[model samples]
Target: MNKSNIYQCADCHTGSGTPQALQAPKVRTHLPSVTNYSCTDCHSKVVVNAGPTAANVTAHYAIRPTVPTSNYCDYCHGPNATSPFPARNKTIPQFAHDDPGWDGNATCRTCHTNSSVSADPLANDTSSFHELTTEYGDAFNGSVKADCVVCHVQKSPQFVAAPNPPHDISGMAAPDCYGCHGVNVPGTEAQKLHNPTPTTTGGCIACHSNNATRYYVNKSLFALHANVNTTDGMNNVTDADCKTCHHGAADGTMGMKLGAANSSNTYFCQDCHTSAGTGPTHPSDPNLIKDGLSHGKTDCRWCHLAGDSQPRPLSSQLRYHPNGPRGTAAGKNCLSCHVSANLPDPPFHAPGESHVSDLNACQECHSNADNHAVTPLTQNTPPLVSGLSVSTQITSGTPSQVQFTVSDPMLQIAAAQYQVTNSSGIVFDWTNMTGTFNSNSVTINANIDTSGLVGNYTVNVKGMKSAPRTDPSKPYYPLNGQWSSISNAQLNVIQPTGYDNGTVYGTLGTDIAGATVSTNTGVSTIANSSGFYSLSLTNGTYQLTASKDPEYYPNSSVFVTVTAFTTITQNIILTPKPTGNISGTVTSK
Candidate 1:
């Protein structure tokens, strides 16, 4: 080939001199025709084909023209094609195309060599078909990677479906389908191998049906395992258990009378069993047997076995009810029924038992006969009179004397004795007299010295029966009753003469000035400065009149009296002012 005709070689070649015309220049008649291999080899550095196969030899081939031709480097390297590669390939190489280098397998250097290219090809051309991998980098590996199923056909198994439907007996086509339906769907061969009978209706019964001894047979077989031997077996059963299957049980059933039993068994058995009742017979009792006082019965559950469905007891045959086995006569003695053949010995009172006296009947100290009674030693003893009084009189300085009186009017002196103590607590007198007492009055001339004793003093009188007093022998003292009496009178010791001083002091005022003074039975004075005055008087009444002054007329008069030497204060108001008036008027235009 001619030297100039090798327009662009694969690599730059330089020769010093044409060595002696090694051969005549192999010039062809046609200008150096471009061979497909030579053109591709040179342009491969600028633009490369993707998936180069025979079928896409010319169809998908990408070409870069020489610098000066109409297909110049600038022609292919314009703003739209600055990279000397196909516009489509330069922009979005991910999408496959008919042009060789413009197909989806093109890389960054294919067009970007010695050219300013976008760091991202899809950065400017929003309409490009390219999908930049960096935009979805994290999504490809993160939580949303599974979202590919929403678009691409090959990515369908990535996500789970919502609101799972009933499982098919055949089986799930996709294993990922179990992500949502596993909790609800029955396994394909599970029913055929485990529960072949198809007795249950849904998923719950599929596994639970095998343990018939533990669970109910099915939803329809409500009463299959109704009776449980122990409470633990029927763990979750409740009154709702009956309502679950007996929706129409209240209406009626074969061989079952409904309305008649509603009054007796309207509520759950546990409701009545847990509560107390006052009927003559137990509500759970079919025979209507009665026990206890008045033939009233205790609750049936008090002595019988309990069940889950029914609160009634299992046992029925017995002579007496378990509760309240004895009558009121037995009191709290349990042996009255437990060991009736030979009764146990009665309980005894210990050493400190209470004592009672024969003077009083048992009822006197034992208020209630139903229980044991305890009486104190001083039962029915009358309270002693701590003081005395009288409304009777005696001559002054006569040294009056009187006898002490007992309080209990039914007491007889024949069986009692009396003692008197003076104000100083000294035993002044005592006596053991004998008589039939009609009243509590006793009069004996007993002297009391009034010479030096002046102020009020108290005298105490005490009485007791002679021989530990079993009973009241006379009417003066009553059995089983407390004492009563009238207190002594309060004596006022008085002397004859009394002396008292008398004077009166007061404030004075007047309606007008200068009231006159008078000295009759009491002393009086006229008004002074600021209508005020002073007066000294004996114990008598007097009157004073106002003397008229030139500036004002006489206003009013007042009366005064004096009793003892006391200060009598009073306020007087004056009413002196001008009584005349004047009138006038103004003239206007």
Candidate 2:
């Protein structure tokens, strides 16, 4: 095969600004399954420097042609190929069973055995035909053809008529299909600017649009609201867990049902932001819903509508606001719509913008026209978090303290959250902790539970302001300062050692003295004269192996779970060596 000449690294790198090491050809890693191959055997190699004058070269790096006349994979797997031997002749249906719109009646020969090259797999199949094995370099693993199920479920095609699950996920719980579907929600602050809407049409919009049923399934809420485990002393929460908080006979009665935070007979928001606490202050009058609570608007659509101009109930105002305070196009804040200076296209105001010096002052002076409130308004500014300190070392299944200082400009610090995330990015939000607050700077010290956890982790701290209430019957707003809190520190959790005591025996139930008993983690111990072995191992599950050399075969399949500071008994029985050699074979020789 005549191959096209390519450019060597030295062609471009031996120039003025290039490093000397970039001048040489790199050692290529050939597939281990093949042998006695060299550069240009399957593909071309670097020859001249990269330039317009170079023949048959386009760029400094090798970029495969968009359309190639030949299939390199066919060289080995083709019907008449011989070098690597043709692949097994496996029969496959023209259309897979799971292919969308397939009716389950077509035969394989319709396409495979047809004379038309376009319809024949033997004549047109290429190296890039299968994605897992072609694009990702994954082994076919005996699969005759690429399995679509590797990405989407092939069996549940009835859900959507497609290979994947149905797009409607209204009833799905957390961590189920969330690995692929729920997780695809837009992650960046900028990408999350859409107005939240409620829709039956699933995908990310179903939840991001503020569909209450689908909202809590977000992975980020797992630490705060979702029941992650039983050890946390919380009930297991399902997709319908919303009823746990919203099903009270009355608004005030609902707030008290949540158990923690003494907010009896008060609005639900006050559950975490009690009036007596340091959280943001809540308005006092239930009748003042127009001016004080709902910003003088009975219809929630006005504030909630965005670029689409559609009033989407339960949708977010800030997210859908075509122009937000962060320099979008227009602003959505009270000053943007109320203050005379802002006018038609109220300019964007960044956080801590000097344009509105005092929040309370703006609330008192804004006019009462155009459904505007005539009374004072309140807006929450998150608390400032700093001086975060966590116990640098601790043991698994133990409790430790995570301390951080919080200060709020508008109200007192009410609640704080401490999150511990491992290297794998699994966040553990420590809930149900007793918090102590002081006057000058609220210092939060939470008892962190480290059960079933051992490794390096990052501790993040954030604080919220007090919630002052005007009326117990009205909805209380919760303003969280989590986005501003960036204070973090490292923590290391180690497993406490445990003892493993057991006896090793042979197949005949006789003690196997001096037997070697070992753990899968490499810790080992030898049995004494009585065949009793004792090993000190860290808290974890281990597979034990027992053997006495020539007398018995090793038994390495015994499993045991070990806890910290506890001794567990696990007896390992070794199989005796097979007896009685073949004497008849020698006589025949």
Candidate 3:
């Protein structure tokens, strides 16, 4: 090698030791304790060219200490190795050399070295070594150490360095439990890890021993933890009892340990917070059942509003809980699930006639928590109307009937009424009707007079507990303040009667009596002795004709328009047949 090509110690090493070495030494991004080794520990090889070769430097420093398994490689390359020739253990698992920056791959120089002059393995690089601890520390925390078997089938590896401290379980909440164990408690793959059998010892063997010190645990143990027999709160457990399972040194008495070199040993408080019975279990707290009605005791959240940990205050749970059907946190009121479609299976009262569908008026039917056992019809509610109908189209100045059926739970319908509204939604007419009472419902027929009104209108009927009113300002108000649902029907009042009159005369100005005058609408009238014909029609174009059998030729088609309440006159001139038609034919030949 040329003299200028020789590498000096100051060219690669810096006094601060922050991985600022010029070449391959840049791979050490951070040296935690520099006092553990000296420069000669890695660069002990002496070359005839006055410097250590790149191959000699990387033979021991290629793989860093960040990898957990790298500790096995450090046993021989560390400063404690024998000076002349380090003893190597072949029993340690060997990593593939194709892994970049891990073995003898050429790509290791991309992140390990910074030199461009040399053609060695650690040469011509743009990147420097990055510390794994600084980039991914939170992911490898103590909590996730137990979750390693979720992805990797191989057990966790041993750590030569000190391990991270255990997580504080006090700050955890409900979601933290379901997040690791999964949403469906006994349904996820994590369930097998929670209560593993000796035959199916997949990941549990890491914490539990399967030999002479075997510990038998199964799903039934979770039930034992929940059946404390006290309804006051979580009892039969103390701070001292928790230490035996969670803290303390691992003894052969229990198959659990505080630490393991190659497997998970972490435990959680949710391992025992599950409910255990076939039917209704004990309430989370005694005060949660002060109401006479039964809120669901089978679900833990019915009393423990927070879903996990200690139960919330009694006042808080009751204020936010709802009655049966869906007794969860989303149900905040009795009517939230007590609708007609989702009513109780046995039903509190008779069906059909005894049911009232109310979204906001549940108190009018049931007594709520005050007296839920009483009969439902103890209180009166608004009436309901059904089968409302009227003629869709009618002539002006005509009379029509509006009919409907009204029913009340308390049978207190005192009066029924109907009203007519114009096209502009204005009520112009209101009338009262007499109702014939049957069993629980009443039938009503209201006679309405359109009189002079000519427009589209809507007719509505309603029942009330008080006398009906005609006051325009309060047309819908019932005197006793109880009102029924307003049911409506459509009405169209057409144009009134108009006259189409005409005089039928012969070509010689002679009057033709008994002539028939008919319109296209199937309305016809005979001419009087004076040859005057008349017919009633509405406002529209119509085809008129005057006909008398075989006498003078009938005037076939004539068009005319009649306005409302007005008279239209048209004269019809009919031609008589020639009595001498036979004499003219002989002269043409």
Candidates ranked by lDDT? 2, 3, 1
The total of clashing pairs for model 2 equals 18
CA-only RMSD, every prediction: 35.6, 30.5, 20.5
lDDT of 3 by residue, 1-589 (tens): 4425555343444433325443444323323233244344434433223355444443234232222222322233233333332333212222221212222332223112312112334332222333323211212334443232321222233211211113323333333333222232343332322222112123332223222222222222233332333342453432222233333223212222211211123232222232332222333664423333323222233332323222322222232112221223333333332232121111111122224445435455554423222233323467789888897578887787788888765433456778888757766555668654322477888668888778888887787642122242432123432468788888888768788888899888888899888888888899998889988888888888888776877786688899878998987878877665444445553
Summarize candidate 1's per-residue lDDT along 1-589 as a digit string, tens digits.
4434433332221122234443423322111142223434334544444644433223124343333322222233233434443422122212111122233222222121211222324323322111222223212333444221221122233222211222222222333222222223354322112112111233333433443323223333333223221243553333333332232332333111211122242332223323333222133443222232110012232222111113222122211112112212224221221122110111210011112223234346434222112222333545344334432243234463445555333222222233434456644344443433322333322455444333444433343321113443422112212333323434333221111212121223333335444444444566654445455554455554343344444433545565534555443443344567678887897
Clashing pairs in model 3? none
Collision count for each candidate, in order: 14, 18, 0
Off by over 4 Å in 3: 1-382, 386-395, 429-440, 465-482, 495-533, 537-589
- Model 1: per-residue Cα lDDT at residue 130: 16
Stretches off by above 4 angstroms in model 2 are 1-382, 423-426, 429-440, 466-476, 480-483, 500-520, 524-535, 539-563, 567-589
Between prediction 1 and prediction 2, the one with superior lDDT is 2
Candidate 1 — number of clashing residue pairs?
A: 14
